[model samples]
Target chain A: MDGITRLVYGIYPRSDELRVLISRTERGKAVTGDLRDRISRETEDLLSTFRGSSDIYSEPCVNWHDFFRPVAGFLTGFSLGKLQRYLQTNTFYREPVIESDLSLRDRFTEIDPPENLPAPLFGNDKEAWLTLPSPHSIFQASKNPSGIDEEKFSDSIFRAYAEIATELGRKGIVLRELFPYSDRAPDFLGALNGKFKTILVAHPESRSLPATGRNHKFHSIVASNQLLARAADSYEVPGIYALDGYNTKLEDAENISRKSEIAREILSVPRVVVTSNQHFDFLPRVIADRKLAVLKSLGAS
Target chain B: MTGGLVTQEIGSFRKPEYLSTVFRKGGDDVRKLIERATLETLGVFRDSGLVNVGVGGEMFRWEMYEHLADHLEGIQFYGFVRSFDNRYFRKGSVVSKIIRKSSAHLEELQFVASHATEKIKVPITGAYTMTDWSFNEHYPDRHELALDYADVVHEEILDLKSEWQKIGRDQVLEIQIDEPAATTNPSEMDILRDTVERSIEGIQGCEFTIHVCYSTDYGILYKALADTALQGYNLEFANRDTLLPGINREQRTGYVDVKEFADRLGDRILGLGVTDVHIDDVEGSDLIKDRIEFSTRFQDIGRIRINPDCGLRTRSRETGFRKLKNMVEAGKAFTDRT
Candidate 1:
């Protein structure tokens, strides 16, 4: 229990203003000067709020759907569901299927961070983390896996990610987290381990960590849906436990935190980031804020 | 073949404009809207020639979790929790205690039963789906969690049935348990089956049906679930039509092969989905006829109940009406031919 050190918060829900901006942008509505200014101002406020809360691991309001849409032409249900915000979930995301060569551009890799935010928001690139959908998850959800060379394709994705990580690291970014859809981390995990401090946000469904070099922190999405009987008794690196993703009520937040603490204790992993299971975007700002306060209290040793 | 081409909605109806507006308002107005919606839903089914229809499930606010969660005793509505590709309700406790448990759906069901002249089937969110879709703060284990959920659901169903009897309405033809999350975790197969059994344990009056949608990879667990003594297994077929194995290149069409499902289900009903709910494109009567005909080749047509892949909640009011109408027309066409 004593090994549990720092508690880092990441991916807070998008502020209403930011959500409005993103929705308008996605809808192809022309967002001009006033709206842009409003978005920037809102972004600063949201970031400052998160920064004040605790150790900020990731940006509060990054639209992850904007990434990896280049090869969506070959895939079905690869983009956002036009009818609803989430395809099947309440959270907004694009279920990307890497069908072919994952070609990248600077536009895809660049962190806009919404200009006119506070200097700390802009400057703490070193402390900030960039989350990428794992190459393994992309490959698993791919349409025609037989045609693509697994090694080459994974390496290609890793190389692009590596370039981004290198650039971001040069700018002072400390970590890059992979949102893995599958249990198997790509072969390039070892390679990326050599480049930067990697973190794998374990998919709630696939709780098992990929058999790779211990180069990443395992962020576990411990929804109370499953039995706690199989929680990892030990870990190679420090782990993070994210509780209360979709519909966790406030009353249960502390209980979840306590359960997560027990799991952390059982694992005996050092420096766990006790946070929400998924991005807090599904919640309203006020509710998300309340959740953060609750988590901050419960997360503290 | 006694009940001439059995037709049922998979327990959801798209809210019409009038009803949608009524939902925005509250108090007595909401009850009036629910009554109106229930009547309209029955009309939609009757108009479309569907024999067994639901009470619209409009009171559910287009979400299965919200419908039941709001009525439960001890639930903390955490905003959202992700499972696989979707997010559903997360909570501390699904059911802390069952005393004085009441829901608007129960009231809606009573109203529907009182007014409905036709055979009625009620959609109950299954124990597994409720627990699987929620975050548990109380239960010691998954099995215990699911069992607790089963107890709550079982109690709720009994309450509904008890009220139905008290109202002097005819028996509820079927109690459909929608379990979209049942097959997601393979390890929980036994628990899922047990949950279903426990939910419908002593209920004698109505036939029990478990509806699974989106994914069909039930493995050996399908057989296990069937053995739990369910009357029917309502499965999504048309939505998965594209994924079905085709005979040739140009002839890319075939009725979904549910022979294995039929064999596994034995004498139990196979509420076959003849219409696609996920796609906007309306499947013609000819297509439905073909699908039903193909199903007959493997299973007894007498046991086959024509239905859409899942609930019509995601579809528009017009689309749902059209789809149901098309399904019944196709079922009639098939029956005439047979």
Candidate 2:
């Protein structure tokens, strides 16, 4: 857990103009190869602007504008839920319902990096990571919360994740960032213990860290600072403190540095990854950029 | 409180798939689709025999918050943001001038009010939810931000009222303010109370109902809101069914706490959620009646209205319609006996 302080940037935010463009394109006919290229290039252009930010800790989630679209195929009876304006921080996806046993309906091949996202944005020579909804998240987030056969559901979700992780790994993706929205990360991670390499568990919600098992093999845990504050002793692995929140105000760099420093002290860990508790997509690009610059400065301090 | 147990929708009916596509094009097709969708929804509610009918917020393809945000200024629709709870927002704000009122809502309300032989209720996202749900970039405090939103809502309600009069619609309809984010940050209860109160203020001649879900701690906020001009409280009860013998509390089941809400706020008309929106299997009318009967243990039967726990947009049109039909049947059966 020592000597491993990596600044991570999970996903990139799209501008309103780009969102309209994407919406129009999505509502239009099937995304042609040309249109896909255009959207990807435009998305890359949006991301390239952030390449100069020294503290842009993580790889740009170039194609993650629709967070759940990639995993939409895993659920048998997948229906998109309405755009959650308030709770989702104002982003929308089909509230996916996993009605039956999970299966790899799609080849799980499209889960890899798009060819258009420039390699330099992939952290130059550094190892780049990819993010996906965890099996637990898919199950917990689904409509069928009860009557889910835990062992069977776990197996199915594990298989789907393993297949996707393997495919991403084959593409030389170094880390697979799995978002475990459930409080059962310890159980879920333990199930995937020896299956994948460099798996990072990031919980978007501010949930208490689960009790650690002896076989807990997740590389790192990313969660809310509040959750970490409540259950820091429960975590056996190094934790990345998500410092920004729904109301995380724009403060001066000094104030941000102080808060970052306090979070570090509270965790009492030598290695700390400063990141937003949720995606910074909620803020305007200017504010998000400013916040990132401050976070980068905090990382430097 | 009324002649029979009132039946209403919590808001948001599923639009036909092609209608969603056509409505986005926005022209003659959009108007036709709105009318068709509105009629289809009204027909479903009317067939269900529901007296306190919803206009079936079919115009909203997105959820309540974003749909309202789309019509207002200062809100920039950011692309998809997904979380564990699957609740995301269009990255925007309530910070700007809300020039665009929800005239589309009033249009739908007018259609329902004119056509349907039942009391039409118009549901809108509440100010506290609009403030609580959005990223508050402009306001110095959430309380002030929520009040700003309240002012906007108040203005919209006034506009809606004006529109309602222009069409000669009923003056005594219901306006439901949905505050799904009310309990998201429970520490802001006073702010939420003030926001709700102010949102419904100055808009006279209609009944105001506040709908908050997923939390029983609404007692605190409900008490504060009760001090205002609020007339009714619509809350989720069936989704949180306590009738289940041994279900865990956290698994989105059981209504024991709803009883608490009912006990605390029983003087007001209570719109009880008798259908669980998350499940696909339509609940039988007997079960719905049982849930209503269970509620009668706490509150007066006449004061109770039946609705699904939340919007039916998440379900298929088939499933949503069937559930509403069952719910209406249950409401009628329960009223018949009572």
Task: Name the candidate that leads on TM-score.
Answer: 1
| Model 2 misplaced stretches (Cα beyond 4 Å) | A1-6, A11-126, A129-274, A281-301, B1-3, B27-29, B60-63, B83-89, B94-104, B162-171, B202-204, B216-224, B242-253
Q: Candidate 2 at B26: error in angstroms?
A: 3.1
Worst ten-residue run, lDDT, model 1 chain B? B82-91
Candidates, DockQ: 0.19, 0.16
True C-alpha contacts between chains kept, each model in order: 0.08, 0.16
Residue-level lDDT tens digits of model 2 in A163-255 = 655654522221223244455444444455455543344656535455445554454556656666655544443455434644435656555
Which window of ten consecutive residues has the lowest lDDT sum in model 2 chain B? B79-88
Quality of model 2 by C-alpha lDDT: 0.61
